[model samples]
Structures are given as C-alpha cells and as structure tokens.
Target chain A: MQNAEKKCAVKKCAMEKSSVTEKVFMSLTGLFLCLFLVVHLGGNLLLFKQDGGAAFNAYSHFMETSWIIRVIEIFLLLFFLTHIFMAIKLTIKNKQARPVSYAVNKASENSSWFSRNMEITGGVIFIFLCVHLYNFMFSQRFFHHYPSMYAAVRTVFQNPWYVLFYVICLSWVGFHLIHGVQSSFQSLGLRHPIFTPWIKKLGVLFAALIFLGFLSLPVYFFFSRTSRRNVQSAISHQLKIENGFKRGASQ
Target chain B: MKFTLKVWRQKNAQEQGSFVTYEVFGISEDMSFLEMLDVLNEDLTLKGEEPVAFAHDCREGICGTCGLFINGRAHGPLTGTTTCQLHIRHFKDGETITIEPWRAKAFPVIKDLVVDRSAFDRILQAGGFVSVNVGSAPEANGILVPKKNADEAFDTAACIGCGACVAACKNASAILFVSAKVSHLSLLPQGKPERRTRVLNMVKTMDEEGFGNCTNTGACEVECPKGITLASIARLRREYCKAKIKG
Candidate 1:
C-alpha cells in the first residue's frame, strides 16, 4: 500500500499550545504597572520634605485643573484597576492548574517563605487599597465637598485606632511591593546574565525605601502626640494674648 | 525507620480527595524513595488495605516516571535528584512526610499520586518534530554538525520528559520543558529546516493543554531533577521570536 503523503505542510493550532502566550500578556501588563509605580512613588515622596505634603496636595489640585492630568489620571486608574483584576484572575488560573499532592513536603525547605506565599501578600494589598481609599480618597475627593475637610484629615490621623489601621495597611502594601518588585523583572524578560544580580539588589532597595518612607509618617503621628501638644500650647498662648488685649481695650 | 506518610488519596479524576496517613515501618535509610514505598505497599498488600497507588519506574534516575510533590517540593528535599534516586537518608528515623501528585492544571490526577501527563506528549506532537522527507533517513553524518551545536543539543536532549518542572512552577508553566525540547532539535543541522514551524506549533499545543504562563521565576530550573537550565527558556524565547519574524 502506498504511504500517505506528508500532506500537512505545517502544524497549526490543532495541537496543544504552550503556557508562554498568556504569560507574555501578564508580563507586559506587569511591566506597565512597574512603570506606573515609579511615577506614583515619586509623587508620594513629595510629602517627604518640609511643607512637602501641602505643596504636593496643591500640586495635585493643580493637576486636577489641567486637562492633560485628567487624561493621565484616567489612565492611572485604568492601570491600577486592570493590574489588580488581572492578578486575581491569574491567581485563580494558577491555583486550578495543579492536580497532585506530593508524598513528601520538601520543596518549601529551600525557598524563601515570602516567595512561596506571594499571592496571600498580594491579596492583602488588594484589601488595603479599599481601606486606604475609604479614608483618604473618599474624604479628599468625595467628602471634602460637604464640609469639615481639615477635621476629616485630622481626626483620621489623630485617633489612635485610625492611626493603627493605616499602619497595618501600609505594612501589607510593603509586603506586596517586596514580592512584586522582584518578580516583575522575571516577568519582563529581564533575565540578563550580568544584570540579574544587580536587578535583585535594586528591587530589594526600592521596595525597602518605599515601605520605610510610607511607614514613617503614620508611626510618627501615632507616637508623638504632636498635634495634641500643639493644641495645649496654643490654648495657653491664646489666653495670655486675650488678657493683654482686654487690658489695652479697658485703658 | 518508622515514619508516617501522609499521602494524597484520590480515587479518580472526578472525585475530590484528602491526605491519608499510613505508617511505614522499618524503612532502610539506604533504599531509594521508591524502594521505601515498595516496602510499604508490600505490607498493605498482605493486610489487604487497598494498596496506596504511586507512579515509578527505572529506579535509576534516568526514566522520568517518578514525579510528585514531596513535602511541598517537586521530588523530595534534594535538589537535582529524581524521586526514584532520593534515598531515605535525607530524612530522619521518625520523620512524617507528606506526598501528593504534581499540582498543576495541565496534569490532571488519574488516581492518587498518578497524574495524567499526556498533556506533555500532546505538546510534543505540536511543532516538536522537524519537517523532513519520510523514511529517507538522510545520509548518516551527511550534514556536518559543529561541536558546540552538538554539545548544546545534547544538553537539551538530557531532559527525561519529567513533569517536575510543572510541579515546581508557581504558575504551572511548562516553558522549561517545552523550551528544552525545542532547543534540543533546533540546535543541530538535521533539525534546522523546520525550526520555526516547530516552535509555533509546540507553543500553541502548550497553551491548548491548559498549562498556565511562565512567570520566569526560575524555580523550575532550581528544582529540575535533570538540571534543565533556565537558559533553555531564554533559547525558547529567542527561537519563538525568530520563528515569528521569519515564518
């Protein structure tokens, strides 16, 4: 019998595909988020220096006044929202894929616990974004229009419980960023031989600086009693000034 | 050594399951992991307790039949070693071990620790073979292959088709495994003619098999029993790009 011809010249999608294609999409989106982070951190660090927060806030106000910023702000929201949603979706896909349990629980013996549990860390950050926005964004963006903007800001930070909440949320963000910063490079095809070591170090340093800088503010407000002390001093100083004014008026 | 093995017991692909702990008594420290399991199975057979199921063959680490998540690790605690080659010496006398099937979407559980890795074979059928005239085995050594090409091809060829990479991957990506196979054939003169078509087809097959994406975490290489390097993944990328650009 004559053998059938090698009729099919090329193998098409009829066969199974590799996992690379979806990963590439995830990697590309992850890289875009990384770029957004650098910009976001730069904006937030504006609060680092003296009178920095007010200047930054006014700058944000200035941004709101600009048409370009309006466009970029929309893009920023899309970026964060898309990244977070994709992360959740990807995690589900990952979890569903594994089919077996090992006879020996030996793999985690060598790797870092942080790397093993990145999804949990990332989930915590997702919850944190909600709380952060509830107090900060809801107040500044939505609640500010009604009244008592300063009181909202002060009371949120001034109350010990609220201060504690902020601290916990920021810490979660810190953990998320730590895993994200390192893993993002791998996603982006940045596995250069000589550059990888340096990339890891840079990732660690960036994650640490961002975490520490954000953490310092809430902790300072919580511990110092600075706002309460200033109020007491202001009351005494006001009493003296009022007495002087009364005497002068009487004379 | 008297130890408790907390093995995952699933009756079939359709059923949900949990860990079933069994006591394996008087295991020799020198016996390979599979041998230790053999002792336990022998006991279960005499006692008529539906024998615990597991997959293994070619006790010598060459065949890739032995694969499982051992205590949260692919294979056991040993790096660059297959389960069949893992000796009991790695664990202490009274250690309790957790054993389960390779956890990934592409590899479905057949029964207990036996997973259906036929997805891997499907990936192979895609773009895995070089397009050449049939049965006309080209002149032996007709095409001159460079020494470096031969060496690199051999390195890629060293893969034993093990599913450890899938087990180790957080995203359950088969990039390392696919890339190794792709690179092995693509490196030499005999396989060069169909390189582009091979990558496209193989990659497509990989996705069709329901495998997740590679996060490029390099965990697969670190845990690879054959030491299939992540360089293979890079090579795969380079090949895929070349194929996309040219073909």
Candidate 2:
C-alpha cells in the first residue's frame, strides 16, 4: 500500500512537471518563430528593389544554399510542429476545463476579440501556411516549377483569388502575433512594471510591421505591370498548349 | 424602481440548470446589489415561493463569500469591486439583469448561486503556507524584507480566493488565484523555506482540480475584485521555473 502511494506521488509530480514544461516549450518555440518571421520579412523585402526579381531571386538562392539556414530550417519546422501540437493539446484541455459555460458571457467587456479567439486565428494561419509552403517553399526547393522564386511568387500573386487569400491570411498572422508575442514573454516569466507596458506596445508595433510588410508584396505584385504581363503570357501559354494538343489529336 | 432579474437556478449538482426570470419592484438606487436581492427574496418568501439561494456573508466584501456574474460581468459591471459592494445605481430602472454562479468544471453548482469552492481549499492545503514552530509568536522584524517586496506581497495577498478570476476567464483558468497565493507567500522571507515544494505541490494540486492553463488574456486581472495584476502570474512562473530548475 505504501509503495503504491509512493508511486502515485511520483506520477503526480511528473504530471506537474510536464504541465509547466509544456507551457515553457510553447513559449520558447513561439518566440523563436517570431524571430524567424523578422528574418523572413527582411529577406522578402528584396522583392521591392524594382530589379525585376534579380535581388529577390539572388536572396532566395542564397537562402536555399546556405548550410546554416538549412539547419535552422529543420529546427524551424520542428518548432512549428511542436507549437501546433502543444496548442491543440492545451486548447483541448482548456475547453474541458469549462464544461459548463456562462449563459450570457460578455467576454468582450474584459478581453479583446483577438485574445479570446486565438484558436480561430491560429487555425486560419495554419491553413495559410500549408498553402504558402506548397506555393513557394516546396515548389522552389524540390519541384523547381518556375524560372526563379520571384517568378513563382509573381505568378501566384497574379491570381486575384490567391492574392485575396494571401492578404487575409497575413492579417490573421498579425492578429496571432499581436497576442502571441507579449504572451510568450509572460509565459517565459519576463515581466516588469516599466518594461511590460513597453513590451505590449512593441508587440502591437511588430505585428503591424509584419502585416504591412508582407502585405505590400502581394498588393504591389498584383497591380504591377510585370504581374499583368506574366498573367497574359500564362494565358497565351495555356492556349498554345491546348491548340497543340487539339492539332495532335486531329492528326 | 423595477427590474427584471434573470437568475440561474440549479437544484443540485446532479440536476440540469436554467435561467429563471423574476420581476422585482420597489428597488432603490441606493440599495446594494445584495440588498436588492434581499428585497426580492423577501417578496418571494411572502408569496410562498422558494427564495433564491445565494451565498453571502460579511457583506463588506472581505470574506469573498458573495459572488455573482451580473449582466455578464463577474461581480457585476464594476471594476475592482465585489458583488456585495455593487449598488443598484449602475443599472437603469426596468433593466434586465442576468445573474449566474461561477462556471467551471472544478466548481460545480451546489445550489442556485453557490459553487463548491472546496477545490480552492484543497489547492491551498497543498502548499499555500509556511512552516513555523509551535511556540510563542516570533518577532515581526526578525527577518528583514525589502519594502518593494513587502508591498508586492501585500498586493497579491489581497486575493480573496473568490473565484472571480476563474469566472471571468474564457477558459475558466485558476492561474490568477493560484499565482496570487504563490506570489504572496514566495515573496516573503517566512515563505522562503519551502518555496520550491510549495509551488510544485500547489501547481500539481491546481492541475488536478481541473483548472485550465493561463492564456494571458488579462481578463482575470481586469475582473479581479482585489485588483490583483498579471504580474503575480509572471512572478509565479518565475518562481515555478526557478524551483523546477533547482530541483
């Protein structure tokens, strides 16, 4: 009996450790992803150089070939997966915590809509990530579908549907970051009277910068002359393929 | 004045609950929220209907006994004030006020507005204390404490364990309450001896009580009657991390 009691105590302690440890992992990985976003936005800014994708393509090439970046890419993938897994797990537990909800919850009175709807924002961002990775990362790394990374991005942005989706997703990213950034610091136990308020303001600023910085690329490319030319050429290219197939079938 | 009260009525934990509406009249703006309820109950008693079962004691708001989710806001539409202290002036005449008990898995409804808050007591029993020898009272100034630490500790210690934080949170998390206890004790020299074990054990018990994790929404801080801040939660995390690392 005493041995069983001791075993129970050990299990309880382990459970306690994991609960806190899970939050720590969530915070650390989230902060790392935030850092990755800064670097990504910095590199993508090369698209605005007006050199018709030369600077951006060169930057992409370097990003693809660098061994350090390759290593960081693996860690980044791991962190992203861990973050999603922990988020889902914690969300499930949180839902279960409140089996009975209030009949009339004026939640807006106390918390922001974005703060309360993190799961919705996060889920939207995750969906966007899958589409984004397929469009750019996977295509560039393995498929080599276009002449250059910038060409691929420009082609994708030429589609009004894709551009609209991209803009919406980036806005969700902003929403996620607005809450996630400072919340990460709090989870990591870094709070100060003077600095915390500053951190909160900085979090909002960082989110806005990321939102606008990434937003400018898609909006710019969608309306740019190059993208329109690319779209017309793509349409003609499709016509040529169809016409050739028709002649071959007729023969 | 007249008002319509939509109050949550639950017979017991085993029963399903729903909102019951009652029309209350002759309510003055000067009457406290609980006093308004008292008038309603008096009317209900005179009418031979069962009076609304709500918890209240030490109506001065110190005992943390009275709690109501009034009109969707915890402890009514006031900031840093308990339900007992909230007056009818905040509401307009003929307005419909919604009142419900704190909702959480760990805090099941015992009756109408009373929840079983023994879960808090259990968590407190886990480690919300310091050990001292059973003898004559020790000198208060024997241990030196920084003024800032004392003030912070006092601020956090103001948490009355009313479960308002839990009610206000979207996830019904108890982190604010637990962190308040953890921060209040851990900040003082008297609470230093078993600081590590205290945090670990209290957190363990807290999780076992089925409370949710803190998502840092700041709702609890805003809804807290005692005005406990989220900084205590940060301090709790700091102490928790330090304890775990040291172990």
| Clashes by residue pair, model 2 | none
Interface RMSD, in order shown: 4.1, 2.6
What are the per-residue Cα lDDT tens digits for candidate 1 across B87-132?
9999988888888888877888889889889998998887677666
lDDT of 2 by residue, B107-169 (tens): 999999989999999999999989788999888889899999999999999999999999999
Alpha carbon lDDT at B14, candidate 2:
95
- For lDDT, the strongest prediction is 2
Error of 2 at A197 (Å): 1.0
**Docking class for candidate 1:** acceptable
**Model 1 stretches with alpha carbons more than 4 Å out:** A1-19, A48-54, A99-107, A142-156, A220-251, B6-26, B45-52, B133-152, B187-191, B216-218, B237-247
Note the B-chain TM-score for every model: 0.96, 0.98
Each candidate's DockQ: 0.37, 0.59
lDDT (10s digit) by residue, model 2, range A1-251: 97667456545564555456678899999999999999999999999998988999999999999999889999999999999999999999999999988888899999998889888999999999999999999997899999899999988998899999999999999999999899999998899989999999999999999999999999998888566688999999999999999999999
DockQ of candidate 1 (2 decimals): 0.37
- Tens digits of per-residue lDDT for model 1 on A62-88? 654788877987877787776776767
Under CAPRI classification, how is model 2 graded? medium
